[model samples]
Target: MAERRHTDIAVIGAGPAGMAAALTLSEAGLRPVVFDMNATPGGQIYRQLAAPQVDATLMGQEYIAGRSLVDAFVTADIDYRPLSRVWWLDRDGEGYVLGVLQQGHSQQWHADRLILASGAMERGWPFPGWQLPGVMYAGAAQILLKQAALLPSAAPILAGSGPLLYLLAWQYLQAGRPPALVLDMAPASRYRTLMRHPVRAWHGRSYLLKGMRLIADLRRAGVAIRQGVSGLRASGSDALERIHYRHAGTWRSLPGTLLLTHFGVVPEPQLMRSLQLRQHWQHEQQCFVPDRDATLSAGTNLWIAGDGGGIGGARNAEREGHLAGFAAIASLGRQPTKRRSATTRRLLAARRRDLAARPLLDALFRVPEGWLAEQPPETLVCRCEAVTRGELDEAIAQGGSGPNQLKAFTRCGMGPCQGRQCGESVTRLLASRTRRSPDDIGYYHIRPPVHSITLGELAADDFDNTNN
Candidate 1:
């Protein structure tokens, strides 16, 4: 058992939100301890380039924005813990106790105030042959490019909705390795409707302009662009050798070696849901989001910031973190100086402007109606347990109406990923079966250890002797 360290504030996740929160709390005469799962501070949006690598040309000029945040975090007088995998959280009197696994040791810490900046993960919706070895999420592909300066060893094939897809391909083209094809899931109707709503879309003009710029660049480079693609599948015995897709009602097959896909993102809500915080299903984002104020507080002593609450991109997350940090001070009846408050208010206004275009994106990339509309009984639904759609059908036929109940019946979500990879897919599948909305279907009951921990680590010598 590690010693029970104590602090006034504990911020989880070292991304833009948590670091920004720590910086704000430090300026308010408080020392906040920040913890991150990764070894370094930068989160996904501004992920730090590999150690000793300061070259901006490789990771791109935009990555330079994260340097100041990481630097400010290092200079702050706050305790920072990296490679700390927080597993469990529990209410203890007026505070909270966090169960953490660090460096192969299990430990616990107590905090009077908790800030959750857990960040986001790429949205996963099962498509045919998605489980193939050579297929991966577009976000994962971007990580490889950012962290290792790596590119596909073979021709890259990208498909699905959202801007990230095109952006990653553009980055690949910049690296002088162009993809074999681009299969867009977005139908023409979505863009036509978006153009008609310029009044509401104007607020998110920056995002719109950036997306257009990426698409324009890819087209100029002679990248094959196929819009309104469906029936996407990978075919090969040992690895992906061909991509089968349908465009304009014509079935076609393209030779490819890698298949990258994405459809935007959603928060990793395991920690928030494990805390039993209030959350609701967001139809727009097609995921659950913690209920939070503009200040980002969800409970009296609990605050949520960043994409973990909702997807508003990196800039909005930083602004939200500042608000949540200052709000923590105000909760204790300690208003920050007017200058600080004024700056955060300005950021808050910008955050709102950034959020204005979300509804438009939501409609355009709405989870493909066909995914939940029908399921081929032979297709795998739970990749971890090898549970198939046929098995799920039997479970539902036997009245497994909820995700939790399905887990008990077929072990659909009891996997190493703790349902992160399959929760949305499972929920949508059952929701369709029961003729109810996903909210009515509910999510799996999340318990912790959130991530796996060794048996010996849980029984380490540092545990409280009184309990033993």
Candidate 2:
């Protein structure tokens, strides 16, 4: 039989938001259980290094700040279960039933409240040969460098929009191997264009400073930094050998062993979607965000924080998480101290101001038009089912092949990756061919056992395992 556990609150994900929420809840006299897929509590923003003795030197001061927050949570005496993947969430009476797989065993937990802080995922823009062996998301390369101190390759091309591309490029240069080129999709002039909103520009000063630092370093290193590269493609048969792009009314090809591309970040809402929560289009960020109240409560005893709500980065995520914790405690008929409430209100206001600038930033750094169209017909669209663009197009032409029907017909979304890499592309293609809105196309049907589990594990279950 699967083991059963109970807690006052169950926090999904161990990133900054989850850790902050768990710590606040624990301090308020509630025992919260924190579940993380990784073996550590830092999440992606505070990703720890493989070597135990390497202090904050490798990750820089900003990342070390995140480490300090993790340390505080560690001292708060909360139940943290690392390496636990939560695949299902069901309404149980007035609370929630969380289905988790830990160390190859299935388990369940009942919590009076649940906080989702699953964080964000890198948004990808498809192009010719994007599925090449050495072509990867910029965030993926950063993970490798953070956890293993390994660069993507000696001569890599960083191409994309947003601040992360420059940050990763700087990291690669600092690690003794400067990237071959920095092909920025969003031109530098866009920043000046956004300056029309003084409040927004002022709020984003820190990000601007970081970008300036990267540009200065690139100039000093004599690394080529192109500000307007579009129509990117990778070339070579087995592995990535070269990257081609167009810039400033000219086509340029750079020889490199690896290509790192990123458009921006999107909320990692797989668990939230699994729960059938209402989601709405966030036009500012070009992504879907869970419908929630000002206090960050999704509904009932369920709360969502951090990038799972929307991409607000670390500072905004922490503020939102603390508010969710206080709101959860207040729901139990316990009012926090007046001073604490006032402080939280102030922080929340600042977060609002910061998040208000997201629309301008998103507009300046949005994904290019016709990005997915750049893909060849043979390019792999669905990595899970090995479905090519040709296959998806054919399925759409057959009629009645919406995103869900296409999944049923081709098993396009029925993979371990859970459609993270291909869902957006598939939805766009379906909408274009069906002449329907992307929202009308809808998402795939998600069921229990969201991730693959061993057949023996499923057979050993004793309780009723039904999908909602």
Candidate 3:
């Protein structure tokens, strides 16, 4: 049965942004109830270390910083619940009601203000043989290493752009398991786009140095790197046998059992979109982001923070969370005139400087035209229903009105993933064939129950009255 729970503040996700928000709000004398689907608090970026008393040096400075954030959140005066998945959001008087599934039981969690820090998901890079058993995301490989301390069976062949691809290879190299090959999607001329103001670049020189060091470390470990690479395909009759690619106007193949790739990341907006928040399409990030005020407030009762709201890294997300914490507490009618204006100003400035190089990153790591383009008729686009790309195209050709309308024809967005894996690809592929801009194409008409939960859980749930 569902239980009625009242929280002054409800923060979703336990990543850097969520933890930062909870910590800041706690300092301001508020107890925010935090719900994280992950068993631990660090979200993905700061995934908890292998052991409680392990050396932080091995995980690198990024995870070290994440450890500090997790520590702060751990000590905060907040009700922390791990392994809690929120599947629905509803209007509750001036506040909101969250349908949360915790430990296999449903509960109605209420709060005057809600903050979403659900984080981002890897951009899909569908290719031939991608559905094969061994072709997985580079981020997924990193997760195995981070959460379970597991390494690939054999040296991996990484094909993708973005710092994550490089970072993961570097981690493998650092751990004495250098990648077999790194097929970089970035062009040689990408450095030209990085031509930024000296002072601005110098302001973020530490990060710049880190990038150089990662590349240098990987090279030192004898990892083969091929830039401007394209035409990636994984082929195996039983398992992943080899990867084929075209490089320097020639087709080449690499003998490998695993092919890990990622173009970059985009916000996972299923929750935000389901709630019908104000969303805008960010050109650089090539995704829809929820719109919010300076305080991160979307409305009187809704606040969104972190990469789920936008694609800033952990540092920027933490800053946004801090600001949103204040906004949320004030919205809930709690304030003692305390503000972190100076800190917010500095964080915002640093965040801008940090992301100043993002356009270059975006250009360098962009998926090739049709990388997510319509696949062959037999190629699966919607993995949940086994819907193929040709089917999607045919549905579009059959005079489907838009992305949402195609659901009736092909059911692309109605899968268990609810369009996360195939949503962007479907929209882009549709726009390309229809000669319509993506803005004109529109997004999936997402409804409630954004995440999966058992019907038995909902059917047995108790509803709380909001009239009080």
User: Best candidate, TM-score-wise?
Assistant: 1
Residue lDDT tens for model 2, 360-434 = 677678775355555678877787778877777877777645778888777787778878777777777776676
Top-lDDT candidate index: 1
Candidate 1 runs further than 4 Å off: 50-61, 461-468
What are the per-model numbers of colliding residue pairs? 3, 0, 0
Residue 251 lDDT, candidate 2, scale 0-100: 77
Estimate the Cα RMSD of every predicted model relative to the unseen true structure.
Answer: 2.8, 3.6, 3.3
Off by over 4 Å in 3: 1-3, 50-57, 196-205, 333-339, 374-377, 459-468
Residue 52 in model 3: lDDT: 35
The global Cα lDDT (0 to 1) of model 2 is 0.79
Which residue pairs overlap in candidate 1's backbone? 1-461, 1-462, 1-463
- Write down the TM-score of every candidate: 0.95, 0.92, 0.93
